[model samples]
Target chain A: MVLKDILSIIFISLGAFFMFIGSLGLIRLPDFYSRAHATGKVDTLAIILVIFGLVIYEGFSVNSAKLIIIITFVALTNPTATNALARAAYRFRLRPWFKKDKSKKIKKKMNWEIEIVLFICLLIAAFVSLYVKNLLTAVITLSVFSFFTALIYIAMGAIDVGFTEAVVGAGVTGVLLIITIYRTSRRSSD
Target chain B: MHMFFIYVSVILSVIIFIPLYRVVTGPTIYDRVLCSGSIATSSMVLILMVGVIFNRIDMFIDIAMAYSCLNFIGVIVFAKYLGTLGSRRKNGT
Candidate 1:
């Protein structure tokens, strides 16, 4: 029994340690694929370890049998599901993050030039949407406009307002407009 | 030993927030979904450890199993939803 206690302790602690590492990687990793890699791979080993420890602690019993089943289920299912999500994300065109040119060492102020340009593009999207003849294009462009507005609020440090704008302005309003267009007509006003 | 379980669970609960930070401010929906899946996975372990502390692991084991199944299904559904949503947007636009 003492041996069982020690073994369970060792296993569960190791499981917890790996779980921490996985979660850390999930947050700190630079890209979606890397984050997925962290969680998908590390958590599987961590869960199996933790559950195996529980199995050892429980000994030969119906509960242990059930735990073994869980281990099997988790082993087979976790990676498959994570892979599915990753593949779907790729299909969705959620672009990967890339580091800026290392050799150039551009000034931070210079970065604002691109930000300003993109901001102007977003502004033009709003105007273009107003004049666009196609309702679908207008709705999509308006969504982009609202999303840019949310980004501006976030930059100004009003996180709550930014989040609200992102949710209500970009997400909810866009969906409603799309639905309205679909149900009524795909035509926009002159 | 019980004290040990308490310590580990406490530490793990704290660790959960790392992924949650990503879920909240993730740049894309994929990041949010990925972090959420991680959080759910960690929660399964947390639930089991809590069960051990309560000396009701048999009950908690069942709960953990259910959580695992739910986690898998939820991610799969999310993938399907995003797949179709993307295609619909493309076809519509």
Candidate 2:
């Protein structure tokens, strides 16, 4: 009996601590996702611990069965509900908050004139690629857009990024595009 | 032992304020929903502690089960309701 009491006390104390921490996280964490992370996962664990501790205290009885049932039900549902709420928030376009460097000043460097010309061309390429009637032309224009993006990276002095963009965007993706385009016979329904 | 349970229940009650604070200040509907979930969980724990304190585990355990049922159903239904909300808004109300 003493052992049982000691065990139950230990379990319940631990559970109360966890519950406090979970609630603290709900308030202290910034933004929706972090708050969700704190409440959803931690709260579930705390409830489980508390209930199981209750069961331990109750011994093998009808009350223990009821306690077990609550634990099972909570364990199953809490995380599921948390995930669903998160998905709904995401679908509703809830923007997550993050810290930004407000004091950081924006500075212009390098040949910005060339950047302006490239940016305009990029916009034009993107537009043309989307609205063009021919599939092949769309693919080709997309490749051109990719090529221009690579040039922008070069202008930004990211040489390694520029190389990656050229290879993946202009080389591999261009080939894959042509292959996918030619592979299909049903060009258009309209 | 009863004193221990009493102290534990008091702490649980105090802990609930943190989640309640989030429910008030949370920007999105889901954040508020999440906070409510957290509070319910803590309440369930508190219910168990109360059961231990009163030495009537049978009666209080049922109440906790009922609270759990309500919490799960409310949250799930709310999530389902909000799922298509974005698409409806995009479709111009």
Candidate 3:
């Protein structure tokens, strides 16, 4: 038990460090491309480490194997798809960060307000659904407010749904938004 | 077991928020997409960890597997559409 505790601490701590570094890169990096490097690359590594720690805590369950497999597949595919998209952005003349004053002539164009509103609305709805008294309301609300519910589910140990929600709700939806935006607007509208 | 799971989840939860910020504030479309993809991947692991905590490994495993597949396909489709659309706009067609 002592050995397991120690191992769990090490894995979880390592995962957190990677997440911090990835976020730091997001803030510190000068350009969008570099920011992608921080978020996509380092974040992936951090999650895998965290998952490993969780498996140790669970002590060899059937579901743990599935989680490991999912992690492996993500590790393989995320970077490649991200790279393709980034390269495409560059091909379409998306701007990169510069050492000196840049964007003197570049046009600023993205409207982030819509996204902000969407997130806020989602947040409120998710909270309300959680507090409602019906199991059906809870599950349906979970589908609508999938992201937050999934996090809670993690705490409650509903591993499968949480895993699904994380990927589908957060990951796929994010990618879809980017793809939709790039397609509708030019590569770097803003 | 409970303590072990809590520590792992807490650490993961805190670490992943950083990448989430990047996805939110990313300057370019591709950068945002990449960050999103990374988050998706990370969340998969996090989800599985949650399963371990709850002791419902079998149920969570299926969902995680399906989600990974969806993430991969979604990215490719979006990429292809964007690539083609960019060309169309350039040609003014």
Best by DockQ: 3
* TM-scores of chain A across candidates: 0.53, 0.51, 0.58
Q: Would you estimate the TM-scores of all the predictions?
A: 0.67, 0.66, 0.67
Interface RMSD of each: 12.3, 23.5, 8.9
B1-93 per-residue lDDT for model 2 (tens digits) = 777776776566556545544544455667766776676566556555656666766766665666566556656655765676666656875
Please give the CA lDDT of all the candidate structures.
Answer: 0.69, 0.67, 0.59
Candidate 2's C-alpha runs over 4 A off are A101-190
DockQ-based CAPRI category assigned to the predicted complex of candidate 2: incorrect
> What residue runs in model 1 are displaced by over 4 Å at the alpha carbon?
A101-190, B89-92
Docking class of 1: acceptable
In candidate 2, what are the lDDT values of residues A111-153, reduced to their tens digit? 3244555566577668867886655455545655665576566
In candidate 2 the C-alpha lDDT for residue B90 amounts to 63
**What fraction of the native alpha-carbon contacts across the interface, defined at 8 angstroms, is recovered by model 1?**
0.45
RMSD of each candidate relative to the true structure: 12.8, 24.0, 9.4
Docking verdict class for candidate 3:
acceptable
Model 2 chain A weakest lDDT span, ten residues long: A103-112
